[model samples]
Structure formats: structure tokens, C-alpha cells
Target: MKNASPRWFTSSYSENGGVCVEVATNLAASHGTVPVRDSKTPTGPSLAVSAEAWTTFVAMTRH
Candidate 1:
């Protein structure tokens, strides 16, 4: 992920009174991971999960 930056965004379905997490899936292909962070703290530390793990997590949430 050379020269690439995280493009964080919250899901459009999120409407829970400002309590949401942001995710940057844009780096998944290049970095093999997805960066996640709290929406209220953009400058805080982010957690990076493997691309496959992130995919599985989202799919589970849909069910």
C-alpha cells in the first residue's frame, strides 16, 4: 500500500446517534487488510484486520 492512505467512511445504514465505527476498505486490495477506527476519534489508533477476516465479518453481520 505504498503512498496510499485510508479512506474512512461509515455505513449509510448507521443512524445510531453518533455511535459508529469507520472502516477503510480501500486498502484491502493493496495492503491485504482493512483499517477500522472509531468515528468519534479520527485521530485515534486504528485496528487493521486481514482482508479475508474483514469480508467474513461483514457477511456475518448481514445475517
Candidate 2:
């Protein structure tokens, strides 16, 4: 999967010296998958979930 440079975005709530979570909304253009990764390891593997699953995860974690 060359050229698979997923752009990542950190959480607005993140405000520390360092964090490792990044969400790639670029995959949302497909309206099917959402990409999640660890910024600490850019070369690390990524997980792609359905948009609905991603939304649910976010909502549940908000509490």
C-alpha cells in the first residue's frame, strides 16, 4: 500500500507534552471507513472501522 500516507488529526482536548492518538478523517470521503492510529509510531499499523462504529466509539467514550 504505497502512497498510503494517511493524514492524522489530534484531539482538541489533547494538551500535554506528548500524545499518541491520531484520527484520519481522510478516509471518510469514502463514507465507509474510518482510520485510527498511534502518532508515536507513524510506521505502525492502522485500524479501519466503519463510520458508524467510529461514531459510536466516540460517543461512548465522551462519557
Candidate 3:
């Protein structure tokens, strides 16, 4: 996707000195995926996880 531009946001549970990831769930509707990146390196590489997989991961984390 050449024109993929995701608006990323960090989780509220993230700590001040802890490593965390930023996610752009907004692109899921059109891209069918959620973009994830390290909060410490915004310009670094990002991973695009499928919506189904992302949902599963989120569900697992809640428990």
C-alpha cells in the first residue's frame, strides 16, 4: 500500500519508563490491518498485523 498513512496512538496503560507500542487501528476498515510501531522509535519500521490477528491478540492480552 503506497499511500498507507496510519494515525498512531499509545495505550493509556503505558508507563513513563517502559517500552510500548503505538497502534493505528483507524486503518483497519480500509487496510484490513492494524499498523504497530515502537513508541520509542516512531521513524523505525512498523508491522502491519491482520485485523483478525490483531483482535485475537488484544483479546488475549485482556485476560
lDDT against the true structure, each candidate: 0.95, 0.78, 0.92
Best by lDDT: 1
Error of 2 at 14 (Å): 1.5
Provide TM-scores for the models.
Answer: 0.93, 0.73, 0.88
Off by over 4 Å in 3: 1-4
What is residue 30's positional error in candidate 1, in angstroms?
Answer: 0.2
Residue lDDT tens for model 2, 1-63: 334546788888887657758888776655567888877877788888888898899999989
TM accuracy, model 3: 0.88
Worst 10 residues of 1 by lDDT: 1-10
Give per-residue CA lDDT, model 3, range 3-63, as digits (tens). 6679999999998775999999998988899999999999999999999999999999999
lDDT per residue as tens, model 1, 1-63: 286899999999999788999999999999999999999999999999999999999999999
Off by over 4 Å in 2: 1-5
Task: Arrange candidates, best lDDT first.
Answer: 1, 3, 2
TM-score ranking from best candidate downward: 1, 3, 2
Is 2 or 3 the stronger prediction by TM-score?
Answer: 3
TM-score of 2: 0.73
